[model samples]
Target: MQLTKGVEQAICIIVLLSTQDNHNPLASDTISEHLQVSPSYLKKIMRKLVVQNIIRSVPGNNGGFSLAKSPEQITLLEVVESMEGEISIYPDTGLINKVFRDGVHTSKGEAVLHDVFNGANSLLRDYLAKQTAADLLKRTMEQSEIPVLNWNITNPSNQNKKE
Candidate 1:
């Protein structure tokens, strides 16, 4: 139920990069400054993102970090997995077996619990996957005082809504 701060920062970073001029890279310091995090700390989070290919590092004077793929291509779950790894809700399979003295009834109860937890986890995964980074980008643009031209032009789903 809880998301790591690193995951939050990573998503924020992605949103910032998406709004940048021409999707050009932004250095870590600039990103950190925007997010109000220390450059050094952001650097570590950025490293994981880059390694996972959520974002790419550019090599040049102006290079910093940029999304490896378009916002439409990146998912919140992917970003989270990159930063924090896979999450397990009710990961302990043997807990029910150890705790309950009644055998089959306890086993049935455990099965039900597993089904509920697993179902919830799958739903969560689906929700995150459907929430692309591009979605966040659009939301961010909407909230920003600066106006963006042709913002929804590239997103087909948004385009449909506009028409």
Candidate 2:
């Protein structure tokens, strides 16, 4: 399963917001500069995030964007879903049907394959939902060695635990 660049960028944007020192919103232009993403594209992604209440936009001269809640409250799955709609690891039904019709596998075989795919997808989503943005931020802060200016606390360990 491949994660789109839009989804990747959305995650990055959320992480960046989580790391900010000030409660004041961050302008799209500033975010664009920091992440080296196009302002127009970032704005489109930001709009989706705002609509989902994952982030909120403040209006006015000093306004920008800020998280609606703490990073711990946001899950990676939520950020990904906000930008990508849904997580679909398996190919669409049309493709699957075509493959089966093309005699790539017997009907029984196809049924087994579908069951396996569904099980795998469910497992992946459950795993993803367990990891929150706060967990990601913690790992980032620990590995970078650069002092976290936004939050005073440090992660328990600098090394990431393997799956």
Name the candidate that leads on TM-score: 2
Query: For residues 1-163, could you state the per-residue lDDT of candidate 2 as single tens digits?
Result: 6778988899988876776644667788878877788999999999999999988998999788888888888887788888777777767465556656756565666678778888887887788889888887778666533222332224323423321
The residue pairs found clashing in candidate 2 are none
lDDT over C-alpha atoms for residue 55 of model 2? 88
TM-score on alpha carbons, each prediction: 0.76, 0.77
Which segments of model 2 are wrong by more than 4 Å?
Answer: 93-110, 143-163
lDDT scores for all predictions? 0.75, 0.75
Q: What is the lDDT of residue 37 in candidate 1?
A: 97
Candidate 2 residue 123 C-alpha distance from true site, Å: 0.9
